[model samples]
Target: MELDRHGLLSLYKTMTTIRHFEERGIPETGQRGMSASVHSSAGQEAVPTGMCANLSDDDYIGSTHRGHGHCIAKGVDPKLMMAELFGRATGPNKGKGGSMHISDMSKGMLGTNGVVGASIPLAVGAALTAKVKKNGKVAVAFFGDGASSQGVLHESMNLASIWKLPVIFLCENNGYAMSTPSEYGVSTTHVSDRAQGYDMPGINVDGMDVFAVYDASAQAVARARAGEGPTLIEAQTYRYYGHTVFDNPLTYRSQEEEDHWRARDPLKQFRDVVIPQGDITAEELDRLDAEAEALMEEAVKFADESPLPAPVELYDDVYVDYPVDMMKRGVNMSV
Candidate 1:
């Protein structure tokens, strides 16, 4: 489906933001060795940007370790995320949680999980809450191919289908599970094929193409909202980095394989294919790229300037030694 000018630009900007956020730790930011927490979503920007576009602030999303892109797409402030990675008190979780645990309940971002397939059950729980409350809200689990192997994900899918919960199991099959490629681990040819085991619809989309992902996710979201239970979407995308910042991808995958995926970069695809087809011009798109860079630079600066959490506030979000003392900490506590 074709998108309007505003929609196209909005998707572009979101993808650009994710790309930059992930790239900040690369040589482009001149701090390649500075942070180990940053997980590169370098090429997988379209999945979250497109899928989250179909969700509202009330609609929840549970993410994974490589979740900066997901949080940014869901309306969390990039500056705060950067600060969290920098271990600053101004972070979403007061810098304590950092990259793996960025949670902003006000924005309906349940939390970014470090554990594989953990988001599935968490999002299912949120959907159950929504169903019980009759809130008419949907919950989404943005997981990966690696997490697809986890038993909890299968259990969550079965439970959601049995109860007709309003949840979408959005999987980002980014070709590899860390250094181990997906082909060696996953039994099914496509992750979505397992959706049938739970008696729900399964869709496989070109995760590299933003518009395709957007359209597919929109339909699945509409189905969930209409009380049609859940749908599993396996977005076939690729990540242009190792499992984490410390990983060297060249050790496992060949440079040619990496080069092949990099050539079909989502941002490049949007700029080249969508821009000429949509109302916006290449110049306008470039302008947006420059703007995104400026915003990320500001975000980095904000993160760097943020203060570190104090030792005294260690129990800020935890069960404290005393209730009255915790009360003294106030209701608007950090995190």
Candidate 2:
């Protein structure tokens, strides 16, 4: 919880990198004609950086569709992420999977999926694997408030508690699930309350406060690594953009609400704390910001020049082994 100068610098760098990457990466991807519009993690930058700050590269993390921050915090190369967003062969998924499917397993980033809440069970499964192997690793699932409605989330929580899996369910509750306010869809006001049903510990955190998220996640991680069961953490946060870029939009939320959240941005809060408490200089922070901007520019260039996937690769990664039922049904193999 007490961040040394080095840790604070790293935290600032990560949050800034994530914020810049999403801001620039999405537009560039659109310009390049990637079919799917991005689902951004604009105002919710701290949840990933703070949670992953306490984790090692060996620890596993499963991220949702709005996952650019998780990827950056988990040590994914910005160039590769940008390449994936741009749908270039130089991407982490070799241009096969776009933003929603970006992954770097070597860095313990399982994957990001378009389907909401799917990562919850995947992370719990990874936690169980870590437990069985006695690897002293913990798995974290980064999901959204909307994802809490999925049936699988509850199932995953119940199983993690019953088996004492080393997992953390992090719900980034940004007030709304797409256009619907969370209060309208959710039965409970606090998403963390769901953990009580499975008899596991739960904590609610200010998602915009990077240090608070870091401190709270540290406790949950420590308990998990000590063989305690999973913990549910609901982080209250906001997003500045629509669910995706292609949305018909125009009437869901107000500009005032967006402005309110922007004023309380996590990166700004981190800067305020570090400048006073950690002896960080604004000039130094500006240097880091410039570096982030430069790196992202290079990433865009790399993605722009990278090759596209070969046509033959369409059926290559379909399955480790083609299913017998699939063959029996005589389904069309080409995608």
Candidate 3:
């Protein structure tokens, strides 16, 4: 699976964009005094970048709390996403779903789940829909090392295997599940190893290396599209920031450990691998980086300028068919 020059640049662009989005958006949360804390996915850009590169707008994906990268990779507009974080009416969910709950059904992003392992079944259900419709589309479930132990993950894997659903169970094992390290939590050395129990192919890839992730995901996606069962992919990645905006990782992990992972930064790794190939130059990558920065600037401006949701419309979108008047009428009634 040789990627063309365009494909290589696309991968670089997506990763850079995600990096910039997180770097810029995290600060906005603070400046705006947002109540909801953002879970930054700064260093784990490669996992979503590589996996979503293999998917189309019609394909589905379920994301975790740290899922802005997933949304960006899956073709959701960053401007809309930023607006959502700002709680603006122009947001994808009309300011209802904040940072952790950002979603765009049109882009096949089911929604980022606040619950640890909840998104696993959402992707599986989407896979079953694709299977029933014979749409040839696949779904990817993006979770973390902590969620790997959740029962929903195991149950979803088993169901997908039995039904031969076109889904990929992607576990972004970033060493720790919030504060709990993988060593103290997971029984297996690698989360993918558990896939054997469900009779699916289990793969462990260097999540920091975009090319490695791309290759593994491409194969898994191909297998799923061909009617094969689900594949469990454990990406050994790391998050540069704490689990959420406020939690300091230094409490549980050492600076030396964080520094070690930071040394092999995914963006730098991409440059190291691609620049020498002679197809993409340093100037080109710099230009892409500048473009990503500019895009985030515009996203922030768009979000900041967008109006807040109107208070009277609070009942709007609560139900698909319910009248707003009916909901307002019942608002003051006791149960």
Query: Per-model C-alpha lDDT, please?
Result: 0.88, 0.89, 0.93
Relative to the unseen true structure, what is the C-alpha lDDT of residue 118 in candidate 1, on a scale of 0 to 100? 87
True-structure RMSD for candidate 1 = 4.0
Clash counts per candidate, in order, are: 0, 0, 0
CA lDDT of 233 in candidate 2? Answer: 94
Residue range 1-335, candidate 3, lDDT tens digits? 58999999999999999999999988886789874468999999999999999999999999999999999999999999999998899999999989889999999999998999999999999999999999999999999999999999999999999999999999999988889999899999899999999999999999999999999999999999999879999999999999888888999999999999999999999999899989899999999999999999999999999999988667777888976667758558442
Please give each candidate's TM-score: 0.93, 0.94, 0.97
Q: In TM-score terms, which candidate is top?
A: 3
The digit string of per-residue lDDT tens for model 2 on 1-335 reads 78888898899899899989988999888887885657888889899999999899999999998998999999999999998887777889987778898899999999998899998899999999999999999999999999999999999999999999999999999988889889988899799999899898889999999999999999999999999889999999998788887664347888788888989999889878778864889888998989999999998888888888876566566788985456435665554
> After TM-score superposition, what is the CA distance of residue 214 in candidate 2 from its true location, in Å?
0.2
RMSD to truth, every model: 4.0, 2.5, 1.8
Residue by residue across 230-267, what tens digits does model 1's lDDT show? 99999999989888777888999899998899899998
Candidate 2 clashes between residue pairs 3 or more apart in a chain or in different chains = none
Candidate 1 clashing pairs? Answer: none
CA deviation > 4 Å runs, candidate 1: 25-35, 320-335
